[model samples]
Target: MKLLTVLFIGLIMMGPSDPTFKVGEVAPDIALPNMNGEIVKLSSLRGQMVFIDFWASWCKPCRKENPQIVADYMKYKDEEFENGTGFTVYSISLDKKKEAWQKAISKDSLIWTTNVSDLMGWKNEAALRYKIGSLPMSYLIDGDGVIVAVNPRGDKLEKALKKNRKSESWFKSLFGY
Candidate 1:
């Protein structure tokens, strides 16, 4: 009975095994296969703001959200962030099949050059590292790889991006860009 009581207390004090990051925290780097079957590290785009999206081709809601993502990408691709010069999307697909992943990207007009996957579906390395428990989960990270928003979409995503970036007035005030 004393052993059982001690074990119970120890278990209660152990805390969660998986550490979760909230906004203002630096996101852990991820490395996986890009579209060309080449390994692409997430840290490669460190100087630019990146939206890391975890999605799968088979998920309808993810597919439906693709258009909005594409729109957001196009709109913010060339924008100047607070500490970054450019913005890009780092799409991580939870697809076990390469064909489906590539097909979905082409079909959705996802023009970003950083689409990547492990082709491991739910067992995707990056997805697991990011602790993705659902389809279409995402993180908007700053130039320094700090998470600014989680699961931001549509107008909400736009607002987050807008607020974080430097305005023309800000540039003019600071001796122009």
Candidate 2:
């Protein structure tokens, strides 16, 4: 009976020990310094849909996707699609060198979006909190602070914007049109 009780307790403790951010979960807020030494906080952007992108200068895939994300941001800025939703991409860099991060942001033309980095490389607090084990991870959070998607690709991002636009239109039409 004693052995059984101990085993049961251990099993219960081991259940779901690895916490993964998932859909419907409230995104954990993060605060980090931007390239110009200005602090940015995730919670401060309440009521705005946000995309949190985690990347590093050394990751080739991240480098390739940077332009695509920038384009998506430009395409959706202040434009309400069918679903009455707008988005902002908040890029967080994991680069070890501050110059490298600033240079990459400028070269990639990621100027219109908010960019921040702790210059801690992989030891960034945000990365550790989000359990990021790889580069190019992203999270899509709704205005209410709930995570709607995770690790969405460029194509997926475009599709999501279009879908939201359509929904917004439908809502508008239902009321007056």
Candidate 3:
């Protein structure tokens, strides 16, 4: 009985643990310092479509993808969504230095969104909480806080946002907006 119990426990311990979260679930909240050093909470952006991106100043791929994300941001920021009213990005940088992060944001022209960081690099609180094992991790959540997409990039990012977009004439043709 003792040996059987030990084997069962061992198997249970070796089983895979859930990674942070997944699509369709409400995204876990993250509170960090914005560019202005103001504490911003992820939940505060409720009632809008939010893109939560985990990236870094030193990450080349993140830099490469910024322009596309910026373009998407501009395209959708003021637009209506099937699940939310407006769109915005909640960028979390995993940079150890403040200057490098700020510089990257400016150089990338990521000026239209809420860019934030704990300045802890890999040890960033949001990264750890989200179980971010790679650079440029991203999630798209709706107004209700439910995650709609994971790791969306480039046209895929824009596509995910657009797939659920409310048509320009949807309002005029429907009773509810």
How many clashes does each candidate structure show, in the order listed?
Answer: 0, 10, 0
Give lDDT tens digits, candidate 2, residues 56-158.
Answer: 7766678888888889988777766432356788888989999888888888888654798899987998988887666678887777778776777769877
How does each model score on TM-score? 0.83, 0.80, 0.83
Reference-based TM-score, model 3: 0.83
User: For model 3, how does the per-residue alpha-carbon lDDT over 1-177 read when each residue is reduced to its tens digit?
Assistant: 999977754543332244467789999899999988999999999989999988888877778899998999888898888878889999999999999999999899997658999899879999888877766678899999998887777788888887668783475357553
Better of 1 and 3 by lDDT: 3
Between 1 and 2, whose TM-score is larger?
1
Number of colliding residue pairs in model 2: 10
lDDT measured at residue 147 in model 1 versus the true structure, 0 to 100: 89
Q: How close is candidate 2 to the true structure, as a TM-score?
A: 0.80
Using lDDT as the yardstick, the better of models 2 and 3 is 3
Ranking by TM-score: 3, 1, 2
Instruction: Give residue 24's error in model 1 in angstroms.
Output: 0.6
Best-first order by lDDT: 3, 1, 2
